[model samples]
Target: MNALLFIVCVIIWGSTWIGITFQVGHVEPVVAVAWRFSIAVVCIGLWMLATRRSFRMPAHMHVKALSVGLILYTLDYSFLYAAQQYIVSALLAVLSSSVIYFTVLFRRVFLNKPLRREVLVGATLGLLGIVLIFSPEFTQMTAQQGLVLGLLFALVSFVSAAIGNILSENMLDEGVPVMQMNFYAMGYGLFFMYGYGFMSGASFTYPDHLEFTLALLYLALFGSVLAFGAYMKLLQRIGSDKSTYVVLVYPIVALGLSTLFEGYQWTLAAVFGVILVLIGNAIAMGKLNRQLKIS
Candidate 1:
């Protein structure tokens, strides 16, 4: 069941970048993200009501959840979309995979948990893979100030995401159920995102084609609803450290889809990078076997 959920998340989230790309010309990124969450909130709320699930959260934790969601969903995604305007989508995708390293660092500093050596090694290899994937983009960054700014924003997005993960994991530890927490968090995130869009004078524009609307629906339902819900559930069940291996696989899936639909060229560097990423994840998870001898 967990493996199935993990694969579902990878596939849905892998496709989310394509859907988001489709949304770019119609509405401002912030506005699109706000709409996505608004739709998801309504759908999830209805489901909770129909299923007779409790919506109550402890009064004290409400603020925390809202803050995390604002940082994670609202700000992180906003920066990511904006960054895409300046950077290649493939480069952005690779940089986003660095979230696992940030997750480990944040866990150590804020939570006082010791970083595992295996996680550090995995993070190093994963970062190297990202560097190789985005080598051309890095050269562009040195030439263009806007590109540099975009990279900075992307890093900020990763930091906020790590903060959100830490906060969510802590909340889970405090006995907050994933569904209830997501309900409140997403509601708050939507509110903040919409508020920001309005304050920024972003006009909500709609595309004339049914394809755009269908893409939005896919992001709201499959990406936001099913993927996020499944991921949070997995975090609760397997713990955040193990659950985060999903990040390692997501880019591979995204790259594969790009190859199929976007005619991305297969290269030796990419293949080698993928091998390192997979091996690194395996090592991090302690799945590598060691020989033992008994006297």
Candidate 2:
């Protein structure tokens, strides 16, 4: 179940970048985000009803869910979108790798998990791999005044995501079912997204193209609903500190997809990056250590 959920999350989220590309040009980013979660909330609510699952929770759980919504869904994405406005895509991708380390940091601080040496080593290799994968883009990045601000926003996004991961894990430890928590968290997320859209006077620019609408549905169903569901469950099965390594695999999948669809030419550096990422994953999963002992 753990491996299955992890694979589901990595593949779903990896494919989401394609869906995200289709989401643009017709809607404001935040509004699109709002729409995604709104659709997810409706679908999840229906699923809960159809499955006869209880939706009731304590008042404090509602608060916790709302907090997760604000930090994870709202602030995390808000910062990422804003950062992209000022920075290059390659830089943004590289900076986002900080999520793994931030997850480690939060787990130690909040959950009091001992900082394992392998986790840091694996995270470092994963980050280096991502940097290698985007070496060309990184080389071309210009040092503008907004670069610092963009980097800051990206870090904020990473931290927000880390907080969200830890919060979900903590909730699961408290006996909240993954689907139930996700249902409420997504509900609150939709609520905040709508609130932000209204307060910011974001215009509702609905997609007229069939492809765009299809992509939006895919995101809401696969990305928001299924992917998040699998991811949070993975978090519960394996502590957030380790499960957060999914970020490391995200870019490798993106690059492979790009090769097929975007005509991305794989350089030697990129191949090496793929190797490093795989090595990092092995380290993270403790496969290398186990194999050594078995031999």
Candidate 3:
């Protein structure tokens, strides 16, 4: 069940990068994100109603949802959509994979979990792989203003997402139902996006392009709702530390799509990096340790 969830999440999220790229030109990124969550919230709300899931949440859980919405939906995705304007989707995807490290680090700091050696090693290798995959883009960094800022924004987005994941894990620990939590969180996220848009003077124009509309629907339905549902479930099954191994595979699928549709070329460095990332995920998951019977 966990494996199936992981694969579904990886595949869905991988495709989201392309959807996100398509989302770029038609509307303000913030508003687009806001709309995405708005649609997602409606879907989740309907699903909850159909299944008779109560919308009642404790005050603290409501607070948790607010914070998670601000960071994860509003800030993280706001940065991500902005970053895509400055970089290729594949590069952004590669950089965003750093979330694995942040998730583990926050898990230790906030939850008082001990840092495992395998996780550390795996994070290092996986990060190195991401860098190698985008090493070619880095070489031209000096020439491209967007590249540098895009990288920075991607990092910020990663940190925001990691924080959100930790908070969600905490909420789950408190026995909040996943769909209910997400519905509320996404509602708050939409609110924050609108607030940010109002404050920043970003136009809340609705996109008319069929491509943009379809992409937005896809992002809302699959990326936000379905992918998150699978991922949160995985987090429940495996814990946040291991659940984040999804990041290890996101780049492979994102880069593959980028190469096909976005004209990304694979270099030897990127090939080597992918190999290292796979090895790192294996180690981080303790598959290698179990095989060796290491303590």
Q: Where is model 3 more than 4 Å wrong at Cα?
A: 140-142, 146-148, 259-268, 292-295
Question: Candidate 3 residues 1-295, lDDT tens each?
Answer: 9878988998898888778877887778899999899999999999998999899999989999999999988889999888888886446656666787888899999977777778778778888888888788767655556678888888889999899889989999889988988998989888789988899898886767888889999999999999999988888777788788788777788888878887988899999999988888788778798774533
Q: Which candidate is the best by lDDT?
A: 3
lDDT of 1: 0.79
Question: Which clashing pairs does model 3 show?
Answer: none
**Model 1 poorest ten-residue lDDT run:** 286-295
Worst 10-residue lDDT window, candidate 3: 88-97
Report how far off residue 152 is in candidate 1 (Å). 2.3
lDDT of each prediction vs. the true structure?
0.79, 0.84, 0.85
Top-TM-score candidate index = 2
List ranges where model 2 is wrong by over 4 Å. Answer: 143-146, 290-295
User: Model 1: number of clashes?
Assistant: 0
Residue 249, candidate 1: alpha-carbon lDDT: 70
Kindly provide the TM-score of model 1 when superposed on the true structure, using C-alpha atoms: 0.90
- Model 2 worst lDDT window (10 residues): 286-295
All candidates: TM-score = 0.90, 0.93, 0.91
Clashing pairs in 1: none
Comparing 1 with 2 on TM-score, the higher-scoring candidate is 2
